[model samples]
Target: MSDAIEWVAVDWGTSNLRAWGMSVAGAPISSATSDKGMGKLERGQYPQALQDVVRELGVEDGRHLDVLVCGMAGARQGWIEAPYLEAPTDLRGLAQSSVRPDVPGSTLSVSILPGVCQKRGGENVMRGEETQLLGLASTQQGYEGLVCMPGTHSKWAYLRDTHIGQFSTAMTGEVFEVLRTHSVLRHSLTGENDGAARDAGFGTGASDGLARPQDLLGQLFRVRAASLLSGRDSSWCAGYLSGLLIGTEVAAHLDDIGEAAVPLIGSTSLCALYATVLSMAGKDGRPVDATSVAIAGLSAARQQLA
Candidate 1:
């Protein structure tokens, strides 16, 4: 075994490609990222993009670096299709479903992990987030609770003894974007969702959604009406809209969350919002850094290859 470096882990999502070079001991040694993600590149361009980034990171020359990847790079539209593993799966089961893509003339040999799917009630799918969940499972031994990863489409997953039992996706973030940028609600939103506005508007909107989810449609329109009638500012309206959507999703899942606090995995702002909503509802939100968890997950998968 070469003592120089071990393997590389890559998280190739729709918008970005992030990679980490780690030692055999599982400590990260170097890192790189590129804007050329699965969404940005053609199927054939993946090798070059990956090779370029790895080279830029000063990887050992002439070595066939084993690269374990997770995220959309394995999507049907990605470099190679890694089929989805159904719910109630062992978190580490992702690697068993992983697929290796042949990359000619590259110093990297790549294996992309498969995503998880739920086809029960309404159809739902998650790609990159599965890796994070696996990461969560890797570190959170003996943890039995709900994991919420809030993003463009937030995911709520139940972890039973560290295995992923079932999960659901919420379009709360996407819906917030749509209404804020494209709808009449845009007029009431000033594109500013700062802490102050979040404090002022989020609580109110969240309370309304929690109490009366069926009134979401009416409440949505009220953002604009409040701005026009009550002289509400754009920041207030923007925060309110965000809060309302988050509240609706949270309320829907509150019953399932039981007595424990939810472990949240996502960006800081989004996690803060989730924490706020959960706190207001007499629950707690525990933040986990998404990057570290992703690396830990990839490390866990890498261990499987041995």
Candidate 2:
């Protein structure tokens, strides 16, 4: 049993759930994950699922432990609905909107945090990235700038001194997955995508996409043509496609990024890829660990409740 564990921090998303054993000083002593996520669990199974993950800590003897959770756990279809907090709001407001679910006889005291939403010119909602933004804000000490959290549905958020001003999302990853697996382009792909050849292809495609974004349609079709005509390797094609999508996403929002270095939070590989795009545009990209930020954000929210 972890005697030093003051509370538990969880990041429950669509594909997996990660739980951290945190000390009172905000340090993590142990961590574990479950493949069972919001996508797999029913509305009533959340408590048992989460309860099992942290059961080793021995909190079942009437000594209920505080559990701070972010992400899809707060989704409408998840454990309990913690309505989204609007943008241009302070990060502290996230904890304030947290809802405690009735877990019956569970040994955990859970508070699911509210995600952030943009309701103005566009309609978008994020259930997990908000905690990451809060985590980034906590570390940077009043962080103000644009943050890029790239994934299946990448997020670009603007922050003004720890407050979420506004944000946008891109379906680039989902589109890429669909086209690669279900489209005609699937036949053109062969070989494992990696190494120098892939990078070269990515560079060329990213530069082209950034230069002439309007011709993106024509360029996408060229991937198939290149494979048939020049017998281009599937790895290169994959890299090129990734570069094209990432470049296009970045180019369209170039004006909004300003001249300041944009912070890329989340996956190191994905953030590094975004950093490459930013570099080509004469801007710097600062990479921040997604896990660390999420954990810290949970700690901050927990502290607020304390």
Candidate 3:
């Protein structure tokens, strides 16, 4: 492999497809994205959408487009299904298991990284974020630690010796979305943007009524009643709702894992909110950018191809 090959790395998810051209040293040269994420594209159009992106960038020669992909693109419904590596898999093992894209008649050489899964008893499975977690472990020091990645479904990963130990996922964000947008709670929640109200709301919800995990459903409904019975501002309910879900997730996982300063890999705002909630629960938290980690990870993986 050449030391200075130009390549593209893709982080294609449910809602967005992002591509970056980087030097062999892993520095990004140019980037482009499209709304052609997996959720919106038809099965047959996947190749064309990818082709369009490459063509727009004038990367027709396969030699110039050494594409590495991660995220939902590795799912069963994606361009090609990359099988999940079991718990305790390292970057070397992950790289060996990557699935190459079969874009017929196209010159672009592509490899989609498989998602990692770890079983923690029962039928629970953790995917997608595990790869990001491994990517984090690959670059950052202190690989043996717990990592909390917040998203539609938040993931808590345990890493040891550069391999995944066990992890769990919580449907916190999805439940929050459903309650706020579809349930009776929507009636109490105003779309108003008030920082003071949000802070107070989050603080109140974060402290009260998170002791019992099973009570989350009931507590969510109370947000509606609290607004109506006490003339609670609806706008504040959004923050309350956020706090409730986060609180439940934290409560469920924190004690079992013991308190260690977990590195959070996600957006800045999300990490900040999570940090705030963790602080409320008396756990130390640090936030790291998953985007930068994604780029770094792809670069690390690309080194294998080189």
Q: What are the clashing pairs of model 3?
A: 1-306, 190-234
Model 1 scores worst on lDDT over the 10 consecutive residues at 1-10
Tens digits of per-residue lDDT for model 1, 182-201: 99887788755566865788
TM-score of 1: 0.95
lDDT per residue for candidate 2 within 1-306, as digits (tens), equals: 587888999999999999998887899988888998999999988988888888644444456688999999888888899999988788888888899999898778899999988799699899989888888888887667789988999999998767888789989889889988988888876677667878977887788779887788788887798789987788888888888888888887788877668888868899999999989988788998999999988988887888
For model 2 the local lDDT of residue 4 reads: 85
Error of 3 at 286 (Å): 0.8
Q: Which residue pairs in candidate 1 collide?
A: none
* lDDT scores in order: 0.85, 0.85, 0.75
Expressed as tens digits, the lDDT of each residue in 168-253 for candidate 3 is: 78888898888778888888886678888887788777665356556886787768887878877866788788887887888776
The TM-score, computed over Cα atoms with residue i paired to residue i, of candidate 3 is 0.91
